[model samples]
Target: MDSISSRIQEVTPSLTLAVTNQAKAMLARGEEVYGLAGGEPEVDTPDHIKAAAMLAIQEGKTKYTAAGGIPELRSALSEKFAADNNLEYAANQICVTAGAKMACFNAILAVVEEGDEVIIPTPYWVSYPEMVRIAGGKPVLVETKESNGWKMTAEQFEDAMTPATKMVILNSPGNPTGAIYTEQELRDIGEVALSEDIVILSDEIYEKLVYGENKHVSIASLSKDLYDLTITVNGFSKAYSMTGWRLGYTAAPKPLAEAIEKIQNHSVSNATSFCQYGAVAALKGNQGFISDLRDEYDVKRQFVLSRLKAINNIRVVEPKGAFYFFVYTGQLGLKSMNLTDKLLSRYKVAAVPGIAFGYDEGIRLSYCTTLDVLNEGLTRFEQFCREH
Candidate 1:
């Protein structure tokens, strides 16, 4: 009999990726499937960013870089964090990784220890809990309700903490929920983390895509105490539409940054050198393209939410940020997996089931594609409800 490590056995496969892969295979087989299952932007990487990468390759900057990051990219990220989020980060306080996923995993490895508790609010991205489990920390989940717009309450978070709690991951403009945390709400949690000496891992990768006048507040700005305890996790992926480049960086206390660097040194070693150059260009070049993408996303968000809300059994909150609309489909009485399967087989409108994100009552739809595709997908969804 073959034996795998207990750690490997304990971690489960990513459900969202599994469903997405299945849909991709069908699409490859000539099915006209609308792919709302992918967590990436459908838009191509803008020309200027691509041009920068080409220039980087021409200049021969494509070799190994420092395990942490290139100096220029680190400085740009630090400045970007300070200007955009009002959080100051020195060069030494930054660590660039392959993606925000690696940045997050490295952060967890740096801070979490065996038997430590990492509080993860549900309706979370598929990776958070699995990453914690891999790090030898128990994932203590706090269920964030749909009625509250999925922003967790102070009480819910407080009830989940113990002396062994080392960190709490807060993904605002969250992945599946798209619920933006009000400033006061973030402050409430920030204060608690400060009190408990729990580190706040603020995943603000979607900070730039918010709709309306709802601002994305950085918890580190709440107080100096909270600032010291908070690690601001952000990337070039969502904001600048650079997901494929695999460039992400985290700004934490200098010591924590060092520890993450050590892990990187032993692991993947650095983010791609040319990609780091492209990331620097992304931060410094035209900011207007981001606004252009956000405007389109806002239109899609409204269109999809209004359409879903009109359906009898579906409940969709107009998402305040990001590209997703997390709609409750619980009345279908179909386990989310079955609902998704039926949608794929019969309707060909593929969306991610909420069960993948640790919730079973709903599904996530990405409106990141063309308006025509979104409208067609919504039409299929509307019909699916009626027929079912």
Candidate 2:
């Protein structure tokens, strides 16, 4: 048999998936693992959203619609951008795909030719660098150390740019650390990206999930130059608790979006027709449900942040948004993977190793579980830290 492509070999398995699977296998053997490694909300899709999908399917809305998106959904999503985000996207500039991840992949493939460079900030989404490599481009990662709450500075961004830079991937309400970028900070990065002539792929998947006083900002809204150069990749999964629906959309400059649409034409054809209808409901229907969910996440966030702070050997930057807390567990004299193992084996607590998210000596604990269960998981985290 022929060997698979070298590109496939170069891409490492997602560390988060590997750790999650190992913990899952242990649970299958009857171990009581708390499994705080997942990045999703444990909450179910809202009843109204579910009802909408059922209605669509029953109405025989299962056939292929359009490559870009159904007109109704695009129009609704466009209105959503204007209503919620203060951004305008006509139907021509929009294309809906499988999920935000696929939208990101589409953006990368659209812009990244072989050997080109894409600058990714460290403590980034676990998949960004790997996806860049898979698309035959180099991933240029710049560090955002813990002291700065894992944020990229204007100077750091300046140092990472070069003539060959094709794109910069920005993730706010960032995964693992839960660091939400402010509008002023995005304006600074937007300035850098525009000056460098690099395309910006702003991944706003966590836009609606922010907590406390932090607000999610779109980098494209910083200026007209940015609006023309930015590919805004967002989806219904994180915001609407609709991960299983697998619908995401991107609004980009017309010429750039043309390339992404072509790729979508050949690869996946179109997102499920029924799901698109459901997404319309998610976008235009009562959105107070999201706020209700965010309120619960805030309670859990404060609880986990406070509990993790009291531990002696571990240091965690309190997450400002999203549902993650990245804990620096290096002082325990154990690498993060080993620490994860010990935590699972001894305390039956499952947390992803920090190395999974590009930082060694730390671990990511998700607070997306229930109020009672979230507290119990933190107690297990404390037990694991103390015993080590």
lDDT winner: 1
lDDT of 2 by residue, 1-388 (tens): 2588888788888888887888889889987778798877788988888888899999999899889989999899888888878888888789999999899999999999899999998888889998999999999989898898888887898899888899998888888888888888888888888897889999888888887777888888778899988999999887788888899999988998899999999999999998898988887789898999899888888888788889988888878888898888889899888888888778888889877778788888888887776777788888767877
List, residue by residue over 1-388, the lDDT tens digit for candidate 1.
2498788788889887887798889988998988777778888888888888889999999899999899999899888878888888898789999999998999899899999999999889999999999999999989988889897898889988899999999998899889899999998888788788999998988999998989999998888888888888888888777887898888888778888899999999999999888888888998999999899888888888778888998888778998898888988788888999899889998888888899899899988888888888889989988877
Each prediction's whole-model lDDT (CA): 0.88, 0.87
TM-score on alpha carbons, each prediction: 0.98, 0.97
Model 1 misplaced regions, further than 4 Å: none
Worst 10 residues of 2 by lDDT: 1-10
